[model samples]
Target: MMCFCASAKNNDIIDVTRIQHYDTILKKLLYFIDYSKKYTIDDINDTLFSYTANTSPFNQKKLDANYFIKLTLANTGQQDSFLLYTGKAQRYKMYMCDSTGKKILLKNQVTKFSPGLFTNIPYAQIALKKGEQKVFYIALEINFYNWYLFDPVILRTADHAYFSFLHLLQPSRIYMAITIFFMGIMFCMFAYTFALFIRNPLWEYLHYSVAIFIFMVYFGLRLLNIFHFGSLYFLFYDLRYQGLQLLGHMLILLFILSFLKTKEKMPAFHKQVKALIYLQLIFLVVNLPLTYTNTYNYAANIAFDIMRVLGLLYSIYVSIYLIAKNKKKEARYLGAGSLLSIFMACLALYVDRWGNFDELLLRYSGISVLIFMAGVMSQMTLFLLALSYRLRMQEANRIRAVEQLQLENDRKELEKYKAIIDARDSERTRISQEIHDDIGSGLTSIRLLSEIAKVKNSESDKKELEKISATSNVLMDKMNEIIWTLNSRNDTLLNLITYLRHQIVEFFEPSNIILEINLPENVHDAPLSGNVRRNIILSVKEALHNIVKHSQASLVSVNFSFDKVFIISIKDNGVGFLHDKITDHTNGLRNMKERLTSIGGSCSISSNGGTNIELIIPLNTYPV
Candidate 1:
């Protein structure tokens, strides 16, 4: 119980607009607890007679029964109106007493008490004349541990208290707005997490979403109840608010359990956690309405205290266990959040238990929940971060899996194509061997027979025999060329250059011409197909033959260069011919152009002091 007196002597009238602030808490007043709910103002003053000073903004204590408080106000010089406001009373009724000891009702009713919400705490305007004084008394019926702020304002008139009190309330209202803003943030997080739960259907997301929602519920209820918004006044003073707190704890525990994967990682610990949750649930069910069952119930308090201690221990144990098991990320988050939450909870419980010993701490009991709220929001935020990391990991794993499957399929298909190509190459080898060994040998034998016949024949038959010999030699050379093209070992560009060197050296050895072959030392082993190789080799042979037979050159040079296009340049120190002369059918230069064009290549011929020929082949003409 607490009361105050705010009376000052006035010598003369002052300006009506002049605002004065006063602190009434330092005065001595009388109060007593009426255990039987039967105390009148007269009975409390006469029988109890115990006076105490209310020298603080508020005083709080456990009122196990009815409590009675009294206050006095007087005007020694001028008649004035005074406003008195009380805050956060569970239940109270007020009556004013005169010097003659006549009592008059000033609040709700004499027989009933108002269960006050935050803003609706009862207040009254007391009018006093010069040298007049009055005493006001209230009987308080507390159903819970709460605070009483003895805030009284004396004014020249009653109307100025609203504006003044409104000004005084700005700080608390800002505090309330901050809490509501946090509530809105938590609401958005709840919506997002629930959406994640819908899409991914994970236990952690669902539990975290529910836990965040519970925080929003708790804050929103407090905000509404403080402002006396809607029907929150009734719920604020009822057992339902307690249920929300219980649910918040339960869901927080659930989130921890799911994220930790306790069943998979530590089965024994998981079972113990489940048992703890069950015990809390059972205790909550039994503890409801327990205050109404007894005048001063310690059963609920004892049970809750046990649960709170056990919960704190369990959270610490789980956090440490996770860290030891190498889940450091989850461990740190859980540990930080759990320690903060448990600390705040323990602080609140301690304040409830020991508030009667200290008015200053008890007065700020409502602010304690913000700490707990921050802890819960922090825990949920960490869980959200963990969930994001898990999802990214899953995505990366999925992409890796897809790449592995594609690689397997590609390997199998490549093997199949390789087998088919190898078989085709084998069949071509067989045909080349048959033509070279069988047809070529047969042609050589036919030439030998024709030559023998020519040696034995008369003059008229010698010509025919010689012609037969020449035709056989030509057919055998063509067969040998076919064999050269079909051989796999001769498919590389290096082999082509070697063969050209040998053929050109052999052909020009019987002539007066000198051959200079320039090839790159780092010659690429560019692969060539049978058709492309045959055309390129034949074209080079034709060019060399033309130079020896018609250009009459003494020196010839062949240069090969590689870039985006493969280049082969042939030059000779010979009498140069006109473009029309080289274009003649006998020169076979047109054949070279046609052969290069067939394989996405080109041929160029030029003449200055000597004959020069260029064969240009696109690197993409044949696969490397």
Candidate 2:
């Protein structure tokens, strides 16, 4: 019995027998192996007889070189046909010979596997007669990507050889179906995450989508046939088959780093993690270009094994560290999901070797790889669950930020409304003060004149009437001034200057004092707040009035300048008055000081070179 057959058949007998057990049928045949790279049909026939190594019904382990497997079929059975079943390999050949060492032609058969689909198994047909034994040798050039362990050769009646071939195809067909299903699911996930990227435009979503896409390609590459493909195809095939795991590790690291905000939250650890990612990238870059080279192609199998384990360990460590540091959201999603992914991936890693535990796993076609696909499905499902939850949290935070911004806008709008109302009330108060100080005094003078005129004759009556006319006209002028200040159209500094120029020209036209006004060159149309305008107008008017009434000055000068502040200096060539006496006049210098203070301004009175009243008001700012 050969390694591929079961052992219930006779050990040391040659008889025409029909065996039912497929494993026992071929496994009981004798077999030997060789490692000669230059072995041909003649070499296999001549040298195969001297070899003495035995393998079971399946060769589940990988060999580093070309191998020649010789099986002596002792068909002591009524079965007239021997059907050999094996997975597709990069290169293979089979020859048959008898005890006389004469080569006999056997039908060369191989299932034409689809390019990217895992759909078929290859078989070899060897015809036999009852109680006739023949020796067959299969020369295999092992390519890890397309190799699958073979079961014991099927021993069937000559009429049922076609059914035996169909039986051999059943396992791979199921494997192809399950793999396509898994691929479909992974592609769906990729599409879903791509949709997420379109919605958010976040880096995390984009990175995660790319990582999932890589996984889809990785799974596809694992199932595709690598034989007879072009060199470039084999180059990529070798990279994906051997080093794609390295790339996956790097992508996984990057996805975690970006998803967790590790750079902002854990700078030092993030640097270490970043270094690991770069190292894995270096391995990928180095290996990708060397995939076709003999040294790298041969050595990649071992190198990526260490690379995968180390990369996964580092990733898990980073996740655990993040969990410890109380990054609750990231920990909640990444910690548990990453562990599940790692557990499942690790489980998948050993699934192909499950034959050690249950030989039936290897005896069947798709059981081991199907379990691997299930493991992949579990991993991706858990990962997607975690990612979806994280995205929900991100969406919530975005909505919260929008709400906070809206609340801030509402607050500012409320403040603006309040400021407008306060301006209205302050203007009303200013109008009231103008009426009382200017119009009311004018009315009082008219009333006094009327009273004095009642006690006098027609000549005194004429003088009183003239005085009443003057006071009445002055009151009317004061009313017009109040109107001018209250009008919203006169809110600019230029308007204030034009109005002040008119008032100063009119007030001094009849006086002996010469008024010299100096203004800034750049005619600013900048807005003046009601409060600033009101306080400035009132203060300037008071200072000018003081100069006209009591300064006894011959000349007065007013200069307006702006730097960090708006400044108005009114100086007169008059004798100085005591500061104490000035304070006694509440609506005079004291009122000027009070008004300036109200608008974040100040006033200073100096009696040198005339009474110099310098008023400084801050130029207010408005939001953009």
Candidate 3:
């Protein structure tokens, strides 16, 4: 009975045959020993049979026999051909052990491996004589890539235990693990950026999409064995990979184009870029069936590779164009990142092709993806920051301009008001001068005439003297009233209204028109400018005079209130004339309007059942 077993390394071994002979033992081993350091193979020779040593350096202590070793023998002088098998291309050697255990090599055969078939290699093998024990060690020579293939070797015991264990712990397995870890991190980063972009759909959203797709594709391919979903097994190998690749390329291109404003510089180039991206998509769709059919896979692969290269070129072109045309910092960042990713991808693939650093290349595929994502993220951040900065600046400038315009308008309006006030003051001075000159001369002459008549002492002369004196006194009072109206200082709406009410009451005491006052009783005495107060008082006096003069009705009402508008309305139930005829060309009505306007107040007069003149003003603004 034979036993079958497995180890922690997951090596499968079946102990069925005690003695086994293999015409050739071929093994393709990949090891993690530093490629920079070389391990030695010992070619031992025994005294019972002399053997030749291989020309390479001999350091048996460095040789890991369990990691790689095989035994094979054939007639040394006759059959120089043996069947060889290896997964990939590598270098190998043959060594013979003599009776004294001094191993020697018959030949060193280094050859390239063609995948999937057995081929013949011409190399001399050792021949064993009767009653003599012959030993031979055929092993792979480690190179810079740490990959090697073995020739056919005969073993007394055929066991797959060691090989399977080494395979389980291969560098590829570590690479796969590392790839998964970084890919997870990349996926997280992409998701984070995507979420931010969704919150704010800035231009960097394009990069987020491309980065997510790249990581998803890579992660999906890596976790293939876990899902074990058939038909989707070779998703990366199918047209979906190419489709995603093209999509990523198009997104990057669009981002660059939009970022640099490239269309402004070269409109024709933009069209070409669009067409090329579209063609790339079309080809990806066209090649799907070809990729699925085994007979056409090679052709599809070639086409896909070509498309990838072209896409790379297109990206490079856009980047270079942006750098050359715009020369902006954002464009530079985008270009630099794009070029770096493309270069890394190509360099990794090239190293794999050169049969060097296979493990490093696989490991760096994930790293390259990470670098690419980081670059894209950096570019996105820069763009978003720039856009935000620009928008903020624009908003600030717009606000500043609006404020400046408002200030200028206010300044111009102030100047206009000043000019109007200056002109009005000049006119007032002229009118005051006329009142003082003409009226004072008339009164003086009348006073002199009255004195002469009084001196005459006749009855008629006395009456004449008294009449002249009364006329002079009336003129004097009129001058005083004019002076008071001109004395704008200390004038206020409240003071003016109080003075007008007093004058009306006194004037009407001897007449039939009974006047009343109703005003804002609780208003604080906030100061009002002289011109505003004078205008309001004069307007109110004129309205009252017109009511007493024109309206025949006896009952009259004067009301004042503070509401949404500060209002003063004077109404009289009299035989009111047509308001339109009065307002049409009436100097009094026009003067009233001018006075109200000077103080930013408005006045309206209407006579329906009664004559009503209402003046409305805004408090703290219109004159007060």
Candidate 4:
């Protein structure tokens, strides 16, 4: 058996002949802490250095300080060129020195550029000859506020370097492919849900669609950042992304509350969820300054992590509660989807945090992101199902409500018809009573007078004949008045005015009185009830009779004007009388006043400037 000798300590010369493709040089490295940032290549001595014992390849120790590394390589084989990869760093400087460490042959500075699929990994080419040795001094600057994974230092031959670079790129390529696929799914979901919101204008649908859009943007920016595709490189690794995440969470909570009607159905749980949402907002507000100023970053990160955990727990609890207590299939679907999503999300977070540093775990890192996306898609599908079910229920309720309203309308219409029929019967009874009280008695008296005239056949009988003729004329006039009142065709105010003008002219024709009429032009054909029209006409007739008999006025004027109230004024240029001196005409005036009052109208008589009679009728008080 052949025996091999290994280096006793780190910082020992590494033999390049023994180094294979993609070999890790971390175990053979030594580091020095530069607390003051004042260390130079000449100042870096072996006395100030320490071996990286039991340290991770990521070099996570003393993150607040800058680090310098010492490496020595010996070429004892036919290979004349090698490649050195120093992983990721904010900025670094490499010093190439002779074997004696007395003079620096070359100095190279490398700084991080925007990350990309094939760039951002810092590497250097090394040229060597047989039996040649070289020393390389590297200085690394790290920022404590940013979390980053520093990969192990790798050594490879020229031919194997390209393959090693491709190997390192495998995870990013897979992650990019998965991100693109999920992005498509998220866009489709957003479009569909947004269309639903537009169609229904429901707050729940709007919240869900907006939440989907926000998450889509978040994932899209993350994909772009990973590939370094755009100029928005600073947005991904800063407070903006965190702010976006918080906003997305808030929208999701709002969606849940609206979708489930939690305030109405689960008041206690609603309050708890509302409180959680408020706390998240507070954290979001507080984290901005902390992150921007690079102050209390660790504390802020811890608080955010706690909030996320609490949010996840609350979501799970509510979903489970709904599934257990509610019998709705929508609730069951939502609960199952929520639980699965939360599980996958938790797995994703855990894996992303720990997987990047381990070589074996790195292969699955991209899959974790895909798993989270899958969970989201599943949850979205279930939410849509629940929405469809709710829409169906709402449609059913709407149809029932419409049917009930139609039935109520039909009942009201029937009652209206009954009321109309009753009113018609009452009017007929009133007409019959009037005919019996007035017309029947007049006809009986006329018959008795005619019988008396036939028996006597003398001068007194002639007087009885004259009396019968006058009585017949009076009966005919009363019959005409009754017929006019009963006619439905004369129900308009215009018709009433026309009839009144004709009656006034006829009554004054026999008398030597001049009649002057004043009436409004273009009067609206407002409806007048039969009872109202009859009462008004009678009042006007009584006034005119008093003017012809008592006032003995040579000139009379009748004026008509209308607004919401109808006014009729009759004036006579005759000898005016005081109230005490008008005893003979008192009954006639009283009748006129009584007639106007019956139709919710008022009559005022004054003796000044001849007798003036004013009738005021409020049209609104009478029904059409």
- Candidates 1 and 2 compared by lDDT, better number: 1
* Winning model by lDDT: 4
Q: Taking the tens digit of each residue's C-alpha lDDT, what string does model 3 give over 1-624?
A: 111122212111111122243322232111222122343445221111111132122222233222234343333222223333232233456566677767677754433222222132222333344333344455554321222222233322122223222322242455556556655755665666567578777665656556455646744564442222122233334444556656766676676566555578768887888888788878877986676653465567678777877877877886676567665666566666667666755654444323343345343234443444444444444445544555577689999999999999999999999788667666666776787788777888888878887987877678767887988887786675665565444345566566667766765677687777787767544456556666777788788778778788787888877776568888888987774466436878889998888777899988888888999776676332
Best by TM-score: 1
lDDT of 4 by residue, 362-466 (tens): 353566666777777777778777877888898999999999999899989978976884576467556756775688667767867776776678776677687
lDDT, candidate 1, 173-212, per-residue tens: 6557668778888988999989999998989889989878
TM-score of each candidate structure, all chains considered together = 0.80, 0.53, 0.41, 0.55
Better of 1 and 2 by TM-score: 1
lDDT ranking, high to low: 4, 1, 2, 3
Worst 10 residues of 1 by lDDT: 8-17
Give residue 389's lDDT in candidate 2 (0 to 100).
Answer: 76
TM-score of 2: 0.53
After superposition, the stretches of candidate 2 with alpha carbons farther than 4 Å from their true spots are: 1-26, 36-83, 98-101, 104-121, 128-148, 155-185, 221-238, 284-300, 350-394, 408-624
lDDT of 2 by residue, 310-350 (tens): 86687678657756766566456566666666665566556
CA lDDT, candidate 2, residue 73: 58
Give candidate 3's total backbone clashes: 20
Report clash pairs, candidate 1: none
Lowest summed lDDT across 10 adjacent residues in model 3 is found at 7-16
